[model samples]
Target: MTQLQKQRILVVDDEQAMRELLTDLFEDAGYEVSTAADSFSMNRALEEKPCALVILDLRLKGEDGLMLARELRKDSSIPIMMLTGKGDETDRILGLELAADDYLMKPFNNRELLARVRAMLRRTTELSLPQIRKEDSYSHQRYSFDHWVLDLTSRELFGPDGAVESLTYAEFGLLEVFVQSPNRALSRDQLLELSRGIEADVFDRTIDVLILRLRRKIEPNPKQPRYIRTERGLGYIFTAAVTQC
Candidate 1:
């Protein structure tokens, strides 16, 4: 019988105690775990191997986890879950805005933490799988809208002039949902459910933050979005006509 390899998770924290705690926690939960105390080591670990998810401490001794998350999101779609001792709403929102997939405060329940980690990994795996288009009986890899092309296979967004715009995993997922359901007002909850799934422990603001990020990438003027428009009380709608290719 072939045994499946365990999924790997990287835990980044400045405190040795916290790192060891998480290492033990995840190892007990049947995941292959690695620990890093700083950004340098974290980057090196990721470079040397692939990780299914990252658990980052928001407050590091000499590093900023939010900045690290931003840098990570620039190139990789690896899911990130942030931990903070502080319960400041602003910091939480800022972390989400920078593309951190999940956030948890200190004194978190071990069970809840594990559950969230599982949810994130499951969502990542689901998104990576090829989807069969029911309408055409063939998979469509690219979606074109308003002179922009979103290639699902490549996970790249190409601008009108042929330049490529960088999109975080969350950004790409939200954009995918919008392009697929064009002209419909999707509530924040619906958007979150469609993009991340029903099991995601995300707030409504997370969707709003992702929408803002997508507008910045795809809108001619994010201030006055032409494609993703807001509905007074309903939610948001993608006004562009999308064509699958």
Candidate 2:
């Protein structure tokens, strides 16, 4: 297949051997692969070619992966899979909070890695198809809630002040789910099923983290969320009226 026709994936890791291994693995699986040892190289590659997803290491030579992940999410909704050695619970939760779509431990199996890459790419494609159709069918593709506007095509959030807010892929997915079902209490399990497909390994806490991130963007006060209110033992509900344009 032509390079341009293949799905491209970027691997950001400082380890040379690991880079080669990942490149070989992805290429063997019929994907175009690019490697970057640091943020600078990663940025250069991203600027040069569109990437389907990024496999970022948690630790770089002189940089932190979490920080880089946050920086990437601030502007793009590209799926990120964090690679970490420590496997600490805090790091896992924090990575998810930063909108890393998924993660793998250092000693990850190659098959598992392949499975994750395929799953993430599939979900990304599924999420994008609706936006494309909406853009073509509607004059203005936006979802409004509580004076805030979310551009469905651009995946952009605009506040009442007309300022843009950055939302990670997961955060946006959760928000979309809520907006489509406002006033109904959705449990974490239901949310996990709806937003992340049928991925059973997805934790319930991840839904909570995604909710917190979404509230920070849509709620007038994240501390006292008027739109997304917790239902105590049940879960959370989007109480605000949503209008689609």
Candidate 3:
């Protein structure tokens, strides 16, 4: 049997030991690994390498990891797992709100870290596949879901007061997929296939991050997302009915 190919992982930390340790661990487990000490190095590596998952440290000297994650979320659907010493629940929540797919506290078990990394990579792979649909076959009606209106023609996501909010290409793709298949459960695998373009190497849990971004822009209460409903293990569903334009 051909061994399954390993995905590349980027480890960003100011601490040299942590970066080296994670690099060794991931490499030992069959993954290609890269390390970055700060945002500048991270950007340089990102440009030179292709990573399916990023294990990031939230605290950095210049440009915090959270800010970096936000910037990354703006362009790519790269899965992010934040590593930090922060033990506060509030910090974890904030990390999630900022689009970190998972949070790992400092001094976490190595085995547990590997497990979470594997799980995150797997989930992202399932969400990054390309999905097919008839060209121009999809249509959406402008309607109120939470505070935003869906404009199919403009392909724009609007805020509650009809204001335009910044949405990255990945986020727009996710929203279109959900709106096109409203009330239907879209599995992570399905989403991954549909969302990742032919040449894109990024994974799908980026889908979840994009969804969170969309909800933050539209939903009055992101915790209780009115439009994009989590379907537990199945993935997600646009619970709010859409009227086709």
Top candidate (TM-score):
1
lDDT, candidate 1, equals 0.86
Every model's TM-score: 0.86, 0.85, 0.60
lDDT for position 213 in model 2: 81
Candidate 3 differs from the real structure by a C-alpha RMSD in angstroms, to one decimal, of 8.6
**Who wins the lDDT comparison?**
1
Superposed model 3: Cα runs more than 4 Å off: 1-4, 131-214, 217-239, 242-245
On residues 181-224, what C-alpha lDDT tens digit does candidate 1 reach at each position?
99999998899889877766777788888888888878889999
After superposing candidate 2, which stretches have Cα over 4 Å from the reference? 126-143, 150-158, 161-164, 243-245
Candidate 2 per-residue lDDT over residues 41-116, each given as its tens digit: 9999999999999999998999999999999987788999999888687888899887688878889889878987
Residues forming the 10-long window of minimal summed lDDT in candidate 3: 128-137
- At residue 18, what lDDT does model 3 achieve? 92
lDDT at position 148, candidate 2: 88
lDDT of 3 by residue, 145-226 (tens): 5456666454456776767666544565677777778889998778766654433323444566667777877677999988
lDDT (0 to 1) per candidate: 0.86, 0.84, 0.73
Count clashes in each candidate, considering only residues at least 3 apart in sequence or on different chains.
0, 0, 12
1 or 3, greater by lDDT: 1
Instruction: Order the candidates by TM-score, highest first.
Output: 1, 2, 3
What's the true lDDT of residue 101 in model 3? 61
True lDDT of residue 195, candidate 2: 75
Better of 2 and 3 by lDDT: 2
Which regions of candidate 1 are displaced past 4 Å? Answer: 1-4, 127-138, 152-156, 161-164
